[model samples]
Target: MFELTRYDGRRRIRGSIYLSIGLSLLAAMVIWVYPSFEAEVDLDQLLAAYPEPILQVMGVRTMASLGGFLSFELYTFGWIILLGLYLAYATAGTIADDVDRGRMDVVLAMPISRSRVVGERFAAMAVPIVGANLLPPIVVYVGARLIGHPIGAADVLAVHLLSIPYLFACAGIGLFASVIFDRAAIAQRVALGVTFALFLSESLLTGTDAEAIGAIAPMRYYDPNAVLIDGSYDLVGAGILLAMTVSFLVAAQLWFQRIDIS
Candidate 1:
């Protein structure tokens, strides 16, 4: 059995702090500024400006108001950076770095299985990840409450909930790459490349020609704005993401079992 997080005595405390600060800044941007109170922008015009087909690709839908501020708006940025790319770099590097730094042999000889080792690494990285993902909505909630424009509790929760599956998918994929590749950089690029491609495929699925096929991508688990602003959760979409996350996690465990420590 394995948990992806544990406290090593020489923990990277600074690394975690940096992640928190970055997430805080992102929350400030999404909840406090731009569409919240600063810009007072129109939703319809923004939607109309972007082509209908293009809208589907970005995981955005017509919210008609600040409702657009919910799921999709946060996702528009979070998915690309937080979900799609960041964890890939973070997770893929952990084990591979151990191997490169001549620490893999030492760690593997401990009273632990390979699966547990990889899982612990993932959990450690996930500390900041969950923190980063959870911050935006928290910021939105606080700012909205303070500014007298409170977003619903459900709506705020939906954003964080919706993000988990998306982020976990990338996490699993990164674990796969980390086990397969020897170099962190290579694992990261491959992980990012594949995940982004899947995201785009999910995006491009908006068209009739590709719609039939693009649904295969895990990105379909979200309709960002709908869940973010309307408090609507796509049950089927969440189920699909959960399945993918589990599948990826299982795969990572099985795959890492065969990894050679020598």
Candidate 2:
């Protein structure tokens, strides 16, 4: 049923593996340095010296413990910010690049409809999203054990699982951009900018009068600190993210169906 999805997904697997390995190495490094950093530095004084707004924006609830440190260092910065932006950037090229290269015309000439093409192309983004999420948790978990601050497996699992919907929503934004722009470069830049702006909106608007506006941002729902540090899983937030993902995909499909690709 998803022939194009399979085709594109297979093409992405190697790149995804490389991304996973790189992230795993990063997770290892973060874990490796935590003990030395904690022993050498005064975490409480350091956190106290930081301004309130900066801590709020960084989502640094606590840094005295391993879970808290990883939540702030690895999950929040790496998973939420970096991975979200990467997915949006990668998926931004899906359709627009095809159109720019004259490949969309050939693909459209096949039996598939425009909606299916958009849907399948966006679906293929799971390759990198899933790959990046899957291996890093294992690395983080084992690394934490090696460092003697073993984190909970359930909490680690929850953090990665909850991130999936958030990452997919980011990809959906890229898919929407991919359908709107005919040029791959323009689409990719737009997607990256928009995704980052939404992240900023969510991070900067917290507890402010304009916090309501940040609700639309995917980052508002994905709280790695809640899961990893507090052991609290926000299933409702994940559901909302999944709904947003579907909405973006549907929006892209509808838009792609109306556009004149010729």
In order, candidate lDDTs are 0.68, 0.91
> How many steric clashes between backbone atoms does each model show?
10, 0
CA lDDT for candidate 2: 0.91
Supply the TM-score for candidate 2: 0.98
> Tens-digit lDDT track for model 2 on 1-262?
9999999999999999999999899899999999998999988689999999889888898889988898888888898889989999899899999998988999999998999999888889999988998789999989999989999999888888899999999999999999999999999999999999998889899989999999999999999878877788999999999999999999999999999985
Residue-wise C-alpha lDDT for candidate 1, range 1-262, written one tens digit per residue: 4423556312645665676667667766665564444356576676788877777666666545445654455557665545567766667777767776678888777889887887777666656556666556667778767756677878777767777777776777777888787777788778888777877776776666767676666667666666655567887887887788677767877877886665
Clashing pairs in 2: none
Best by lDDT: 2
Alpha-carbon runs more than 4 Å astray in model 2: none
In model 2, how large is the Cα lDDT of residue 88? Answer: 91
- Error in Å for residue 159 of model 2: 0.7
